[model samples]
Target: MGKSIFISLPVTDLKVSVAFYEALGFRNNPRFTDETAACMVWSEAISFMLLTHDKWRSFTTRPIPPSTSSEVMLALSCDSREAVDAMSQAAAAHGGTVDINPVEDHGFMYTRDLADPDGHDLAAMWMDVSPMPARS
Candidate 1:
């Protein structure tokens, strides 16, 4: 079987977080969702578990980062440059902050950054490795 990745994030508002992720094309997996957390499916191999702050605390003793701080940035691969732009636009329109960093285009790859309502970072990227220039 192929490996799967599950990223768990602490969120202040479960419903709003779920909506923001849905806007970015993730679907809710109710089988693993309840009052404290929602399992958002990005693909067959990638899933996000959004947990309420209280729920998150149970998993660790570490303090949650303040809203102005970032513990990690999640990168998601897109099918094309247009898909990256579309998802970025959707994220902004759905209460997330867009362009936390400037867009980057490297001939063979393009990327844009965004921050969810609670300030978790996300990067939408597209790459065509076949056309990439040879390294020195």
Candidate 2:
């Protein structure tokens, strides 16, 4: 079996966070979802566990970062630049912030950043590997 990663994020509201993630193309796996957490599945190997503040504290002694600060930025790869843009729009419409960063276009790659309601940072990116310049 291939390895998998479970990214756990501290969310203030489980339902809203689940909806926010769903708008960004993640599906909830009911088997691991409840009032305190939602298992948002991006793919077979990538899943995010959106946990409530109390639940999150149980796993770590570190204080939760304020909404204005970011501890990490999670990036998801899209099949096309249009897909990245679509996700950015969806994020905004679903109560997330899409103005965290400017849309970056570098010929072979494009990307944009978004912030969830709880201010968890996320990025959507698309790359055209066929157009990548060869390394020296």
The model with the greatest TM-score is 2
Query: lDDT by residue for model 2 over 25-90, one digit each (tens)?
Result: 999999999888899999999999999999999999899999999889999999998999999999
Clashes of 1: 0
Off by over 4 Å in 1: 133-136
- TM-score on alpha carbons, each prediction: 0.93, 0.94
Pairs that clash in candidate 2 = none
- Kindly list the per-residue Cα lDDT of model 1 for residues 41-93, writing each as its tens digit: 99999999999999999999999898778778899999999999999999999
Q: What lDDT is reached at residue 127 by model 2?
A: 88
Q: What are the C-alpha RMSDs, in order, of all predicted structures?
A: 1.9, 1.5
